[model samples]
Target: MQNNKKVIVGISGGVDSSVCALMLKSAGFDVQGVFMKNWTNSAPNIECTTEKDFADAEAVCDQIGIPLHQANFSGDYWDRVFKKFLSDHNEGLTPNPDILCNKEIKFRAFLDYCLEIGADYIATGHYVRVDNSGSSARLLRGIDPTKDQSYFLHQVTGKDLAKSLFPLGELTKEQVRQIAKDNKLITAGKKDSVGICFIGKNKYNDFIANFLGKDPGAILDEEGNELGVHDGLMYFTLGQRQGIGLGGIKGKEQDSWYVAHKDTQSKALTVVQGRDHPLLFSDGCYVEDVQWVNENNQEELNCEVQIRYQSQPVKAQLKKLTNGYKIIFASPQLAVTPGQSAVIYQGDDCLGGSVIKDRISSDFYSWADNRGYNYQVYG
Candidate 1:
């Protein structure tokens, strides 16, 4: 049992965090709950749940008999996260801001704030574990495989992991909910939040349009044939299969269309006939801004990689480059998207990750070159 070591618990007015604080307090640690206000104001038509969320957090703190605190990191979030989100989208790549928030806010800024406030460590509701008994701290996948969030936390370093606690790592979502119910926590019945946190329960395109105005452009097929006019390239992502205003084509109506490429320079969206289209698959991709949670990352290693959160990890080989790393899959993977984190894992321990730059396969290059597209595929 922790002997009254002061720790700050980041409560999000959710069952997971509320349970996190309760479990810590039960363990005899001096626990305090702090609600981080990430998004301060929202555009018109978008619902801002900050006030409601804060009240819920206060209720849970009261129920647990712990003092609650609040921190406004909205300015930090806007400068560090939201701007980058808009920049990536404007460049036709869909970036996950949650990953950025975890790196910059929860673990970086929030951790700093907690440490400055005299807390020994900061805890959160993240569904991942950290093994600090090692030579250096190591991040492990949560016991609950279905709710594991290690993929979204690849940017956190070992130094930060050593000072962090994940109370819900050993518990599944159902187990957490049941524990909350048994304790009569206020958040036990609250629904889990989904999608982008800032734009809660609002139309995605509508929220983005407030920042990035619409720029209508021609949507082209793989063969460079104009198909339709797109609202904007920022609204589409790699492997997107719907909401393209597409209808039954003459003979290809039976086959579904998928976004194969987004040409930001030409302001055109390239689509393909079927999910199995050759353009949608790539042998590997070049990743930039690679971050290694483990201090001693090998120059070359064979490991499993997950390109997106929901996708399963597949066999891959990582080779160090002068600037970044090139990840080659055992087999061609579909929709190797840019601006998405490609997290590396050796067994259940998260090694680290980098943003997918672009496809390095010859097929992708040949297709883009043959179409007279002008974009640097490599440095």
Candidate 2:
């Protein structure tokens, strides 16, 4: 059935991508493997991983009997994803670099390479599915909620969705592993990769220190009282509960500290004692730089909003803002961290998403009152 169809699969030495290639080969498609070289050189603490990844990809291709190609995308990765990551952190936002890497590098650069090579379609190991039956293709969540990567793929356009293929979408992680084991793929037993792809498994604080100099900041309590010291404000993210060395909270006892506020002006990190703290929860969020796949009905609409990758879907009212969109959640969500994504969904289909610029707390008015800031409450 897939005899004459030319398909290019992105093989990242990881099991997911390796299994994607194997599946395409089993489907009888004219499969070719392309290993994307995203980083020019591996950073500190992550040396030779990319090289190892390349070797694994090549091994998979050799075992699958397919021609393999490597494309260098370091320039684009630096200009597009890494630069934005730094900018967001400087502004006190918690940016998801993986999402940007997918949007800018994988789908854009890798797809362009596939097209240049005369491939009919480009496939990846993303857990999300694509439904092209309607007027336009729609990206849907993967069957495994735990492994669903649709949140990171909200930036994919309809056109991109139409030409893209996610072979592992219908299968669960276990199923993918089974397929690899059955086929005796080299990465069959490899552990799943975590954290940012380029940054690898190092401490985020250490990673950021390489690019941006370390600027230690005071860690404060909800009342702005200094409690401890953090390596840097950029190192910590909102909703983070651990790694904070507060003296009073001896050895993970007392109360868990959640990042509540950050002051870029004063370089201060404000934290709350407990997850149930009202100041850490938010009822609404402001998203900026919104992009949609299907531009047919670009008007504001009500849909489900996913603030973070594992967050349960929530009903939200969306209105187009001058720069982006204002999303009001049905209930207060805890730790609505800025610099993360606010992906919108309709049923199982991903609508679109944007970076979170600001958050509105349920007790915002009360918070302002306590802070003595004369802020008006707008409906």
Candidate 3:
């Protein structure tokens, strides 16, 4: 690789990105490390570890003999990612802020910033590969099936994918750590960060309640019988078993409860006793804001769809809609929550994805309506 193009690698102070910087430098490219502070712990009691991460990033850059750059995208994150996350939860939906952060902050804001400083490409530690061998770039699943992240990156355009590099795409977790260890990078054995991106580890409910204030509500059974009281609807999600503050009910076989539905009109949460409750499963979902990485990819066809991260892809039939698309799964999916993304894939290539606006199941919707619980209009 004989090139003098400048590449800005987004280092997250983790083993994957550390190896990214090392590999790019070894490949004879002009490499620099950029730490994007997309979130700050400005809120009372919210922990912010960006400073520590920056220090780790600085250490890796020093070891790699490259310059380190800093950029704070908290403003963009708040407006684009955080606000929508809160809004979705408040409206009885589960939103994946990480997906939005990748599209808005990492690729958009961070990419632009890197380009402004004369970068030819922006790279990250994401476990997804980009195929620029074609006329237009294509996003493919990482060689590591257990860690492929193409689902989260479905919304990124082909143009952006062309200019981005994923140095860790072909390597597994173990390989990444080994490379980092060989190079004596500080993050070689560092534990991976979890929870929301940029937002340090904290109690999820407490963090969310701080923004969407607790609106206490009643927990009801499938028949609308009052079971118990909940702190807030925002704290719950479909198929959630913990934190319900409920116990085994009479004549219910002493089984645990799961959140089946949320009646936003009456501020009532419906619970059922079984883990695989019928109400929790849906045949398909209506999606909005659909974006295709390559427009030439199939618009409507049979493919595999994934509704959440760490979920297994299932066979599905996708049909085009005026505003978006509808995915009809071969089998019912559990907890197909709105506000989360439904990404489409054909074999290993990620076609694209969109936000889940509403889940479609005639039986469930009709049952709720008959019981006087109102769900959003089915698309």
Candidate 4:
């Protein structure tokens, strides 16, 4: 069964990666395990888990009979991903750092390191499949749709994916755990990592505040009535229902409040009544930093778009603009926040994605020149 093909699997102290290494080794391919250290800092009173994660990764490699190599990419992560993330928040935008991490740290930095060390290919535990049948590799969603990670990986090019192997892509979370258990791996029951990689389970706003200091602002309604004050515009995102601190007001306490607008220029936090308020939805939006998996020449193509990671892909059209691309949803979409990504798909293939920049319109979003409405421009 020895193929003599050297593959480096990214072992992250998780059940998925542990099984990935086990399978690669079982298949007789020369396998090695790499533990990439991306984050080294922690918020106040929050325990640093990087040490334990590295130890766990090492243990899993030992169990799988592979040499575990540690590579510290903390500097690369901060410069390439974290700085831009902080900048996006300062501009009142909800940025996704994971996408940047995958593009900059995981695939670029770590992949390069793996190759320099004489690896034939780099593999990971990401729940995504690469179809290399075509001239250009096609990134397909993992069979288990619930665990598919193609959305976050939409920015990665087909070329990088072609050189990558996703062992967990063909297996469900249950099967992965079973394999780990059968092999007696240490990460058999490890909890999945959530939130930002550096922050762990710490309060998001609190952790962010440690980097971006406070900038007090006003909380207003659609009618320009001041309801409350905000610690900073960076603390909240559009459509966020919690942390607004308007739960126990005088008379309007019964009504639900959602973030409708964040104006960094005016230093304002606009809240709208009801979860499904008219001001929350948008018809379309312009996108920047578009990255396509395959070379797509068509300017206008009917496709599906996922505005956020968890949201279902909606019917949309990708229109190439003079300046950039735009996504026109078949129906009004809610909370298509700026700085978030909108991934395009054709059938099961994730074509590409881009960062949302501006919304075309929302029914009542255009008030006077703009302040509160169903339609407003993204920050």
Best by TM-score: 1
The runs of at least 3 residues in candidate 3 whose Cα sits more than 4 Å from the true structure, single-residue gaps closed, are: 296-299, 376-379
Off by over 4 Å in 1: 375-379
**What TM value does model 4 have?**
0.96
Question: What TM-score does structure 3 among the candidates reach?
Answer: 0.96
Estimate the lDDT of model 1. 0.90
lDDT of 1 by residue, 1-379 (tens): 8856999999999888999999999998999999999996766677788888889999999999899999999999999999999999988888999999999999999999999999999999989999998778899999999889999899999999999999899999999999999999989999998888898888888899989999889989878888899989999888889887889877565788899888888899999988988889989888985788977568888999999996889999999888888999999888999999899999999999999988766777898889998655554
TM-score result, candidate 1: 0.97
C-alpha lDDT of residue 113 in model 3: 92
Error of 4 at 150 (Å): 0.5
Q: CA lDDT, every prediction?
A: 0.90, 0.84, 0.87, 0.86
Among all candidates shown, the one with the greatest lDDT? 1
How many residue pairs clash per model?
0, 1, 0, 7
In model 2, how large is the Cα lDDT of residue 47?
Answer: 42
Q: Deviation in angstroms for 232 in model 3? A: 1.7
Model 1 residue 117 distance off true place after TM-score fit, in angstroms? 1.0
Estimate candidate 4's alpha-carbon lDDT, on a 0 to 1 scale.
Answer: 0.86
Question: Over the stretch 287-372, how does candidate 3's per-residue lDDT look in tens digits?
Answer: 98578898854567898999998799999999877667889999999988877889989899998898998889887988877897
Of 2 and 3, the candidate ranking higher by lDDT: 3
